[model samples]
Target: MDIEKTFALLNETEPLKISTSREITVAVMGAGSRGNEYPEYGKLFPGTLRVVAVSDILKSRREAMAEKWSIPADRVFGDYREMLEAGRGGKLADILLIALPDDLHYEPAMEAMRQGYDILLEKPMAQSEKECRDLARRQRETGVMVAVGHVLRYSPYFRALKKAIDSGLVGELVNIQHQEPVMYAHMAHSFVRGNWHDGKATTPMIVAKSCHDLDILKWLAGRRCVRVSAEGGIALFRADKAPAGAPERCTDGCPHEKDCPYSAIDIYERKRWFLYVFDLKRDCPAEEILERLRTTDYGRCAYRMDNDQPDHIVVTLLFEGGVTASFSLDAFTPWGGRRTRVMGTEGYIEGDGKTFTLHRFRTGEAREWSYAPPEGGNYRDSGHAGGDLALIRDFLRAVDTRDFSLLSSSIEASVESHVMGFACERSRLSGTKEDV
Candidate 1:
């Protein structure tokens, strides 16, 4: 297959994919947040996909998926190793959702693929450059599909942006700026105090979180990244930033807890957001929540943690068409939405997550596009502004019909973004530019 030609055609209108009348069976590994959510696809597209088995170290998570999917008790394995073992000789499910942590993605996915299962591997699909390539190579060798979770490409807002650009509404792209605001509570919860705190332990926070942004930028550029440079480090969320009265744990009678914006109690117990990571229910008592915080990683003082992720990062990318792009992963923002500006020779575009406006220089008309899913819509719980749901839809259709082009963020396409991210991290650490 001519991979370059395949990607070149991505900008063109996608052709039809074969249809499937029967449901596709799915097995999930690491029944964590993303794992549980992917099964919701079955709810959205009834008879299109179904969850038949799940594996998670946590019994609570495993039982939850089993109960939700009406999966047989025998299918709920406590370890993904066991699930892979069951799938070694024959395919246990049509597709495997490898939503495990950054470190666990490659092994399970490689095993599942060898066992003849197609996959919907989550973003930052592998730990390093080689792993990403290996996954792609394996997909090519096996003749099965692997769709990385670059969900943003499937969003209506972004889809519209890509379409407008491809249509020459924004002609001859030259420069672009994209910003990812990883809000305060989110930065602290996921980066400062949670599983992603230590970059060396899992993967660089850039690769962990901002790879989604990189993928989006690359997709928009419509060309390969040839050069990359970066500069960022832990700025605010450090040991020296902790207040005098702040304790190691927020619940340990810290006097300044009420004032600190990153207070675990305020963010978790009061605001009632990002609670899915914890075992506690939303309706749980404040006291119970506080006690749980005292023991979990969420209770840690954000400023006193061993986190290596930068509170802010800036990356410069040079694409093949001389389309220069700058990406910022900012954590100190009050609100969270990806803001973007695209400059072309004949037109320009600006977007603030929900709404986007296209300006045609040749024609004096400024067109606008806005996406606001209704308040009580079925996708209220769906994340990434319905990108998650749309991604699953495309992946299911691609796998069921055996037409890889039906999906946007295929492994072949995602590998380029990962390469750029790894290069950026290298450039940031070495204080020098790097080639992608």
Candidate 2:
């Protein structure tokens, strides 16, 4: 329950000795942004981890990953099941890094564990509660470790916040208020006209976007969520909100191209990095980018697209021991980051993901802490404010030592958070409180 102590145990483990040079072999199940991001851990910890095989439906992506890692041609497969089959003979990989979609997580994860490999799964473990429980049961039955990607748990800002709370800087945590501002541009690209547009087709907004917040709430409270109530709906980004005379596709002669904030051409052209979402060729000419946008979902008008995710949502949680928390996710913000306020018996702490301020009742003064990446460090480049790199490092260590306790986001511990997310969705639908 003391998250700081849990992180300390993970960090204090002995480094690999010169004489005991063993590298964990990893097989990637999806070679998208997240898949590519995790393998970069090998670059940070030289010779400690190797990606041996990769599986993706996209030939270009899988082949590119195989080439990047120097994996044998035979080891690359279009199907994850084939990759798992190859690993069953103990010849391919020692671990499975699953960065597949929300609905695709359960199958690959279950198969990988059944094939005798530990797993590093992306969050929202599965689409439904039954799937989550099944994955947990599989891990327990097989005695294989499974680490979920709750990257915020490894972030420096949150870790410091947790430490301060545990050290009684805040006498006792009584309530929390947290907000996730999903920037407007990002919301359009990812939720409005992108792959995760529909809640019924894939997942609810809470489960797909804010599971990390749910996990953090549970972690900070250090108690199980007992009840949840939520209220939200798709307030914007629908057909009714489409501009008059606007075409279904942004590139299809929409009159508001120059003025529309959610114009696909403007958004995608300005931030070319977002092309990764289309899974298309990157760094292409402007004509090519425009052509692709004209024909794909990525180019669709944000309001006209078949998106069901809410533009705003708020959830209230009741934790064990009478603690309470409230969380909000809004897509209309100018910035993208989380802000949190923790109220305690003696004081309260406030954070904006990059810095924190602690106010004490006794001193009538505030203490501040800010995060600065180390000199020549790639924290920002590594993504998630350095949490991604830290997570992979801890996961690699846990795999190397075969120590489940070394991970803070193990499958068993993470499923509860996913449950909270599902419960929030249910509450939103039923218009009543739901038990977690």
Candidate 3:
């Protein structure tokens, strides 16, 4: 594929062409937050995409999605397998949106493709290298398109950064420094006391959380990552780090609750949005929140939890054509968002997700760019700073046109980033550089 042509197409103004009059039917395999978010793109472009079926284990989620989409009771299923099997009788949707958990991705993705459905898969592709490869191979064999949820590539901030680099303002790309500062409260909620605390049970931190960063680095480099070396460990949020007199459950009169930043009540009770991670309905009563916290894993003290993934990690990658990059993930940060510095032979650029600065060597001056979301808008309201919306739009167009180039994050290119992530994890554990 021509790099310039692809970028030109990406920046084109022509509206994406879908069916002129008919709606593109969609089926959702998971009715969680991400699942709900993607189908919402249909509301933006009516008569183009419609969610027609939903399957989820949670009755409230499934019922809510079914009601929202006006899906019939027969089409609402508790099991994704049953949903897919039901679709075999000539009801298979044009696209299957798989927003299931990390471990649940591969099987449904394979099944969906086998049933002749295109996919909009959430990121990491799969939990392991072999699974990633299998999804890639299956896509090839079935001639089905997949748009992995590497939404950063579709974000305006990243797109502008890419355009600046490609304009020769930075010359040939050389090195990239990127960091993802997972905020303290978020780390405690999602990684510590939440579902992804164990690397062995779910996925390594690099693959689970920072795969987006790895994918972004690889995309900007415009080359394959050939090797990686990494070093990190569980620095905090460990059982041994628990304060004296702290109980397993934060509500059980833990003395440190007043001072501990990771106190469950302080974090969960203070923010209504945090309850979404537990699959609780929005605006749940305080009693319900307390009861869930009293029983569920989400209420556990961070330091006393059974978490194992590192609170901080650093990875160095070597890309094809001698391009190199360094990435870091820190969970103890006060603020959250990605920071990046891209250095080339002639100039350099730095950005903090919302704003960026570009400096040219000859001019000896720097230019700044700031991202301002639309009026009455919050950047965080849309996942990944509106990248999620852009990704779904592109995916819908790709599915309609059967053109892989329309997709910013195709499975073919995305699998390489997953491979790099796996290599980094191997290096982190073995203490030796590994080839991707």
Candidate 4:
């Protein structure tokens, strides 16, 4: 699709009038901590992209954010369906941002697309590969302005690294090793043991969280993946790891609160939990957390919950033209972030998550580039490191102008990643290399 034409449509209709000199009156579909708190995206785009409305399933969550961000109470709704209905009727949103749970992406997106509104969809596109294909097909048929939030394409650090590789600083690509330490705490908090507990409830971990890696690997390889081999299991954070004398539930009377590393109270209710929550605007009340624990599945003791996703997975990919890449997702890492190493015939590049070290045979030397993202980096992490702002800017510009070049991940590229991931997951289950 031509990005410029889409941008032109957005600009011509909306015109970005900058009504308040600081905010745009946008109705954010679901912008709680996950999507709305994106730090890399400047709260408002210097007079565009404002949050005039917010919607979420949890009334208190939405209301709390609305109150914090100063969104009018009447503008906030508990139902995303209502928001979409109103948007379709021309009373809802100027632009719709779908930041809801992975499984909830389809309905809102289809609704917004049907309504002819510009949209920014959080990645993986949808819960299933078929859903992703459907959305892509819809995008092609409708020609509505939309951009998937594949932030790596917009991240300056990754972009610069891609540039270094493409510039022949690291000659003819040979092999790559990318390790995304899913982080034990993070996985327990978001996947195996928390809100997104199961594949049916949330999404397959490969797609739910590692789609970005899939997309970026495709982007970096510049070739479609041909085969995938994967192996993983729910190796950690299971019932077998329960501490001695630990109770079945956090609410039940038991010891180990002081020593257990994975204790529910220590991880979810303490001040340290905010580190994972990534909320700087409001401190989560301990009383509120305990109340939720007492009532919700999220509060169940980590060891006893009926969780069934892998805590670790390793996937290998063979790209067309004989390029080989391997990715390992270690969900038990004590520290977080990603580590990558790409080896080529003439050189090699290694990145310890934030910094890049490039070695060239021609120069017989190595150079490193460090990009330290701004503080409170966790909550606002976007566009790779801080790349989303640029990505959003580019997408809006393309939509306003009809230039397809502005898009880093076109529909075709995005699908390649999704297909590759699907194949990898299939291979993981089948115990054999599968065609991508």
Q: Please state the error at residue 84 of candidate 4 in Å.
A: 1.7
- List model 1 lDDT by residue over 190-243, tens digit each: 999888888887778778888998889888888889999999998889888788
Q: Residue by residue across 1-436, what tens digits does model 2's lDDT show? A: 3434533432231222221148888889989989999788786666878898899989989988988889988989997778777776773677789998777889888887887888899987999989999999999999988999999988777877777777777789999999999999999988988768888777899999999999999998989999999999888898887889999888889999999988889887766748776665567678878887878888988988878899999999999999999999999998988999999998898999977888888877687766555443546434786678778878887887888888999998888999999999999989989999
Whole-model lDDT per candidate = 0.84, 0.84, 0.84, 0.70
Write one digit per residue (lDDT tens) for candidate 3, span 1-436: 2334433433332232234246789999889989999888787667888898899998999999999989989889998889878977765689999998888899989988888889999976898999999999999999988989999997767877787776666889999999999999888888888878888778899999999999999888878888899999888888787889899898999999899988888887766648776666667777788888899998888888888889899999999999999999999899898999999998899999977887878878687765545443333346786688778878887777778898879998899989988999999999999998
| TM-score computed on alpha carbons, candidate 4 | 0.85
The CA-based lDDT of model 2 is what? 0.84
TM-score of each: 0.93, 0.93, 0.93, 0.85
Query: Positional deviation of 41 in candidate 2, in angstroms?
Result: 0.9
| Clashes per model (N, Cα, C within 3 A) | 0, 0, 0, 15
Off by over 4 Å in 2: 1-21, 271-273, 278-283, 372-381
Off by over 4 Å in 3: 1-21, 278-284, 372-381
Clashes of 3: 0
Off by over 4 Å in 4: 1-25, 38-45, 64-75, 275-291, 372-384
